[model samples]
Target chain A: MKVSFFPGCSLEGTAREYGESIEAVCKSLDIELQELSDWSCCGASSAHSTNEFLSVALPARNLSIAERKGQDLVTPCAACFSRFKAAEKALTCESKVDVGIPFQGKINILHMLEFLCREEFSEDIEKKIKRPLKNLKAVSYYGCLLVRPPRVTDTEHWEDPQALDILISRLGGESVFWPYKTECCGGSLVLTRVDIIHRLNGRLLDMAREAEADCIVTACPLCQANLDTRQEEIGDKEGVSYDIPIFYFTELMGLAFGNKGVRKWLGRHLVDPRPLLESKGLI
Target chain B: MELIGDKNFRDVVVDAVGEEIFTCYQCYKCSAGCPVSFAMDMLPHQVIRSVLFNQKERVLSSRTIWVCAACETCTTRCPNEIEIAKVMDVLRQIQQESGKQAKEPKVPIFHKAFLDSIKKTGRVHELTMIRNYTQKSGELREKLKTGEWKNDVRLGMKMFLRGKLKVMPPKCGGVKEVKKIFEQAKEHKKA
Candidate 1:
């Protein structure tokens, strides 16, 4: 199926691996991604805080563009998905009049996790896995926004959003339950303000480590950026120890596809997923 | 700088503030990062404590309630997962409805204006939001002096040309569900 795909800013920049992995996996799934023509920024964390209108309009413009094309907008970035969904929610709320913002047309925003969890795709995914991820213990981290406000994301469930865990389990990897799975990864504060990040990141890593998982899998780009890139720094300052690699859900799926050169996509990972992928006997 | 009541309203305060009040260890981490805390008569932690202490009048009327940007810094810091920002939202709703007088903070007004802009336009139209906010806040002259008009006009024109800013609002689906959510929020305030 072809749908308008929004890779978000991070996916274009630091998280290109995520984009590549998504493309790789989609191709394997026989799904076609039609890029939205001339899409703009999703207003991210900055726009939402600096100017509400800019935030909503930035994403709405992209959505409206996608809506005009008669396709749902699918995004890989959790923040992008959440922000886009938020704008759609704000526009749809009748109280937009009360707040002085009026209702606009809505766009269907889908996160990659939701897309991969489709029943039809599941059977194909189960059948296509050439290398089962047997004995690979993994932790699934949601890191907020994916299933939040429940209404916005429209995922399976709000409090217990486990599609990621379910997907990991389907790949023959055992998904471990960790407490900090849905907790905040400190969002944009990773740069501008970071006094709290060391603690937050440390705690999350500690939880996954405690769960004795081989690696942590996440769907959000920012979360991956923070967890993967900053793990060493957090380990340094907090005096904690962790060398576990962070895997994008797509990266894992790409591995399950068991195609050649798939390891290169995982190779681009900051945390060196080779050791973990090797443990699953894919390497 | 002021303690409004003598009684230890800790139970009432904790109940009102919810469970996250005592979770704070007074790290000042939230205040350090807060954008509007400089203008707050009470720090973010103190406001949480005031609510925890059942000092409703003082907590609701404090300048801190008005100054919060809803940045969620305190909530982010609280080791106990207390939603200090959400609590401030509840307090702001109370302050607005009680007709109690408190100094209006710039950030909250800006946020309201921002939300108002979205509410009206279905998406945010920057020029309209700033204009509406300036007029409502009576900051038009200062806004003009700050050269906000020139920059806004330039950017607004650019966005308009790009078709990012819609000239009209979009029709809403599930209007009743949205309304019900708002109605429940209102009832929450009344209760």
Candidate 2:
């Protein structure tokens, strides 16, 4: 299946692994990713917090660009997906404002997890799993944006989303039942409010460790960055040791698919994921 | 405690967020679900109540607005369907537009630096953003003055060595168009 992919700003920089893993997994699944041409930043938490118009306008521009291509839009970053979906809702419901170009919501926006969870792709994914992730206990971390404000995201089971869990199960990994699956990872606040992230992500890491999962899998770059990078600091501040490796769901998928490029993607994580994969004999 | 009874404060908040603040029935669900509520000077539900009471100063100056992560947990959990996160965003905007200083200055400073980065290159350059943010953030400036900024600089260098942070700015093909969007939004804000 072909979809217009919106690799938001993070994908180009700090979260480059996410972009690479998505490409690797898509290639393995024979899913065609047509990157949205000339897509700009989605204005994320910054634009929306400061100005409403710019928040809607920025994502609307990219949405309009994708709409012109006549393909459903997919974004790997949960935050970017939320922004695109929010912009679509705002532009469609509100009074038409001239945003340089006209935007009519002609396409659907799907998070990468949502795209992969589609029924048709299930059989294809199962067929592609060369190395079953048996005995690898994984906890799916949905973070905030993927399934919140149900009206905007239309996420099925917002509080206890099972998309990631089901995907993990299909990949032959055991999905651990955890309470903080959809918890806030203190997202963009990491840039300004490290204390908040430390407190919030500390709880998340503790919960994941309590769950005894081998790794925490995430679909958001911001969440991955926070949970992976701040684990050491949070551990030190809270007087606990946490060494759980955070993985982009796509990286795990690439690994399950036995794609060689998965190593390259996994290498970029702040916390190395190999020991855990090695411990499980999945590598 | 300073009491502010601006009658139009409620209307301004409602109009800006496009959500009816009065519809909130004090369910406390928003506050209960807020991850950062423990750190907020005013709880999420109380912020709404302040708006209802026309306590503009209390609502605008509260540290809650600045600390809100916009995680949408409160918005999602609100039984009344109030967009509490957006309300917080509008409060922050109101706070800034009125030229009142943020109770937590780092949040606004970081946001401005982020938007400035976007405005320049259509994408956030980690290095540029941190530089701009450290320059604008008084807290960071103080840290820099005391040579305590080395820790953050070390982290940046680590990220750089790890290839997580790109040294060069990334430009989108539609930077001109992005600038136009910002310009149009500015005009709308003025209108």
Candidate 3:
């Protein structure tokens, strides 16, 4: 249960709730999160989009540090998980990538969702749930990073991933089946093209609404922010109102575990999740 | 690396991406599955075709490469297993290096602003990054010129009130190492 934690950049600010809920839920599950000291950013979309070498090298620096620890490294951000895994894949597959650091590819880079789905943790999660989420229909949104390019993430059923849905089921919430679960939310275009993002996320929210999902559950910080914040504008422009709140998969786990810290963590969202949580009588 | 009839472009692509573009076979599956195709000037399949035909100018000038969100959905579903997202990245890097104005405009600005933030701080400071982006993006200036500029100050205020926007970035002990990685990576660029 002891794993090195890499709380990526967004977890510091925009996704603070995710970090808080992750820490709170892991404690409730008795999982020890050893902080990876002084980890750099995983280079997300920018590094790869600009310089291919930096994409591998920036993550290589972090992996070099984590590799020395010899423990499973888990990050809350799906983008970071993908970036770290990309570096590991390159280092393992190629011999010429010397980013001035020796990386042996000894550690397993795991997304927090992937970590939670571990058999030992999933088996024990049900026992710790003091209050099961009833009447909460959540559509698990994996976004793009966690499940695509299956060779890198090694995720089976990448097109229709069940990691978050299974966790939702264990938390006693109804995991609604939805096709837009793996759709891209245009996360990398957040600063560049808000117009494109609005349209793309509009499609996602529209599908979620049609799926009758009371709220969308996700693990990516950017997806949660984009889906939550821009939804109002998308509604105003499209004349189809959307009020669905976004939740980190861990936040729900913390709530189901009856962790008291989750009460504050729920308040950080742009589209307030508390209304739905309260109406469901789960808050 | 033959210099005849798209062979140079083909070799460059094969060097950066892989030879998968040669195997694409015009399936159009990648373009069909791409989520951001609505904003792209060229479809994914067409870009592959452009590359195969040595239409480097057309491929680089198009907004498709810059606008691609790198979602990798197209790459995943490619029957030929072409790494379409990586190809987009490769094309963008080439475009950036070409020193021409990006037709997609603000995306490259955002990318530069993001990387500079990372190079300076070992991580992105969102508010700072966005501030840098707005300052550098000429499209924003054009919006301002035409009085079409709609600022997100309200959104900023909302995020700030929600405690999502931090006024100051955290201290990162590994920032020096990050700069070193950037320095070493320059040698890695395929010249």
Instruction: Calculate DockQ per candidate and list them.
Output: 0.04, 0.75, 0.79
Model 1: residues >4 Å from true position, as ranges?
A97-107, B1-191
Name the 10 consecutive residues with the lowest summed lDDT in model 2 chain A.
Answer: A94-103
| TM-score of chain A, predicted model 2, versus the true chain A, to 2 decimals | 0.97
lDDT of 2 at B168: 91
Positional deviation of residue A235's Cα in model 2 after best superposition, in angstroms: 1.5
- Residue A197 of model 3: what lDDT? 90
lDDT of 1 by residue, A40-116 (tens): 55645544544334545556666677878888778988887887887787667665412333335545679988888
In candidate 3, position A122 carries an lDDT of: 67
Lowest summed lDDT across 10 adjacent residues in model 1 chain B is found at B173-182
Ranking by TM-score: 3, 2, 1
Worst 10 residues of 1 chain A by lDDT: A95-104
Q: Residues A1-283, candidate 2, lDDT per residue (tens digit)?
A: 7999988888877898888888989998899999888888899998888887898888888888898999999998888889988888878875654555667888889999999889989889989989999998999999899998889998869989898899889899999999998999888888778888899998988888889988999999999999988877887787888888998898888899998777778777778888888888988
lDDT of each: 0.66, 0.85, 0.86
Q: What is the TM-score of chain B in candidate 2?
A: 0.89
Interface RMSD of each: 11.0, 1.2, 1.0
**Colliding pairs, model 2:** none
Which residue pairs in candidate 3 have backbone atoms (N, alpha carbon, C) closer than 3 angstroms, thus clashing? none
Candidate 3 off by > 4 Å? A94-96, B1-7, B139-151
Q: Candidate 2 - CAPRI tier?
A: medium
